[model samples]
Target: MNVLLIGSGGREHALAWKLSRSPLLGQLFIWPGNPGTASLGENIPLPVDDHRAVSDLIHQKGIGMVICGPEAPLADGLMDFLADRHPDLALIGPGRSGARLESSKEFAKEFMLRHGIPTARYRSFGSREAEEAISFARSLGLPAVIKADGLAAGKGVVIAQTREETETEIRAMLEGRFGQASERLVIEEFLSGIEFSVFVLTNGDQYILLPEAKDYKRIGEGDTGPNTGGMGSVSPVPFADAALMDKVRDRIIEPTLRGLKQDGIPYRGFIFFGLIRVQGDPFVIEYNCRMGDPETESVMIRLESDLLQHCLDCHQNELNPGSVRVSSSHAATICLVSGGYPGDFEKGKKIEALPQTQPEEHIFFSGVSSKDGQLVTSGGRVFAVSCLGQDQLAALDQANRLADLIQFEGKYFRRDIGFDLK
Candidate 1:
């Protein structure tokens, strides 16, 4: 088993390329990994808030399963500091109170209004409630959304549209523009439609859902500007049917895993959800303990199972809804970025040209870094490229033809990735 896999990007290089095609994989680390997870194995640059140097490299490399993959090291508790500095490893994720559903968007909208689930209609305020959060964003009428109850990496959401751009971005996110991750502010209620991504793999109580991406968090191209961290993605989401995934598994993933196991919260890993699709149902537009960058690089290349046996059956709680499989072809992940990305750019730069992929395309890097040996640019969504066709318009035409054979120096992307399923 011996895993580790924390985070560097491109969803930890697509879960270190599906945990290096597990045969119960016996050794694969990553931590500060990049260079497409250094060809799927040993990367560990350490210092993830130095929990005793990640518990002395998990007892000097006898790792035995970790799998985090970001949400700022599972909202900084780092699975309760590696389960109290190494309770025989095996973490996967979710512990800081089930990572406050995703680091508190007002505790995931009051734990989705205390478990009835379906979301949107938020309210959290603080920073001395800026005049009742500007009178609750002028009573939610024009377009409104504001968010930033913590965590701004995915650009702490905005969607303003007016009411003086929602009281000047809620007094500039409770005054600080995301410092202290916007010292409290939620506001929401602009729910319209179309947005997807589901993932699940829980152990808060038997779960396993995966396969249902749909990224493009607007960096321009018809979806207008601002908001990045995902420039493209897609995976069987031609409107997520199956009667809206059985109303998102009985109205929002079975009451968010029965309200995180009736609030005791021993969650195991990956919960994402995000969701949107209005008219046809499903709501929750947030919650992401992990897995959802370019929709995990297009759902880990259509996930043909064996992601280290579903993270060792979610660390032995033995998750099972027929144990994950998913490969109905049609993937597509694009990403590229670096040209004034999410705002401001430039990093190592080099990476001259790249392409000639084809074994159903792949790439995966993300903000690169190898230097002297080549591959440069280091962060603002750098390379994803995934392809695999036979549908989603031939995987968005072979993922924009391998994202135009990769160039570097300010190489933005999104040649209309999955243009809302054409």
Candidate 2:
């Protein structure tokens, strides 16, 4: 079957790698793909924002399926457009109505609250309602989380430890530091605990849960500094035991699917839950309508199932959890982010020697390009070096070892990517 993959990031690279391995695949095409995907499939230069062009290409190529890898296009109703043009073509991603879980933080929080899903207490506010927001923050006390209501490319949320910091964050978000994304804010009580990412392939009724993963979001080592898209991640998270997975499905995932179904938004693709294990109980932090970045690198590394078949099953509403397969082993990924990431950072800097990996190890490129026939930095999180192992420690060791070989000016990566498992 002919397939079209979207987005340009490490996650898309990993997805391309996996999809290319499918024996059922005839031709694979990537839209605005990066250097990595260029090696695997036809990299089309069509404008990703133009849904009409994308639909035209899909029809021209007889594309059997279109997999969206990022939230932007999904949030902008790309799936809806595709469905409108060619309802028979399988589109693996949520439509705009179903994407509200990620596109609007306030809507997600309110939905969770209404449906009895476990989550942090939050209050939403517009920029003009400063006094009301301040009062809500004061009631929630210090050490609150201030989050921009719209997507801010993963830098919208700020953990404020004091009243001064909380007020400053509120001011910055309301003052347009995050552009129009911060026109509204959601202030919530801080929930301190270990966090994990859970991915589910859903057809709005039936769902198949993939292995859990833990991502390091902080840009600095030892879990300090600002949050980036993702610094690193480890898959088959040991913390998510069978009991915890059951609780997640019963108390969170199932309810969420049911809620969306009742709300007239029947989702039909990946559903990513940002979860926190607070006091031994799981609580959702946020939701991503699609796959998580570095986390996808780790998860895909440990997947023993055929990704193409699984996605087809989801599209057909025939997802059989029994047919799904995943590795019992663990996998870890370390992200090499650009210097000054999660803030202002320079791009187009020449990247030196990259690590040589055996077939056993996976190197997914993110924020990189072949400029003048030489690899150069292009995004915040540049590369995700991933390795599979029997355990988390071994995986971490392999991931770090691979990361050490890649050299470039202004390259910064967290030294403790999966240390939380230790």
Candidate 1 lDDT for residue 153: 77
Residue lDDT tens for model 2, 53-82: 999899899899999999999999999989
Give the per-residue lDDT of model 1 (tens digit) for 1-422. 78888778888888888778878898888988887788888887767877678777888878877878887777878788788877767788888888878887898899899988888887888887888987887887778888888888777878878788888888988888888888998887888888888888887778888898888878888788777777888888877889999999998988889888888788888888888888989898888887878888788888887878877877777777786788889898888888898888989989876766867788888888987788898888888888888888888887887788788767989788778677
Per-model lDDT: 0.83, 0.89
Each model's backbone clash number: 0, 0
lDDT of 1 at 130: 83
TM-score (C-alpha) between model 2 and the true structure: 0.97
C-alpha lDDT (0 to 100) for residue 3 of candidate 2? 97
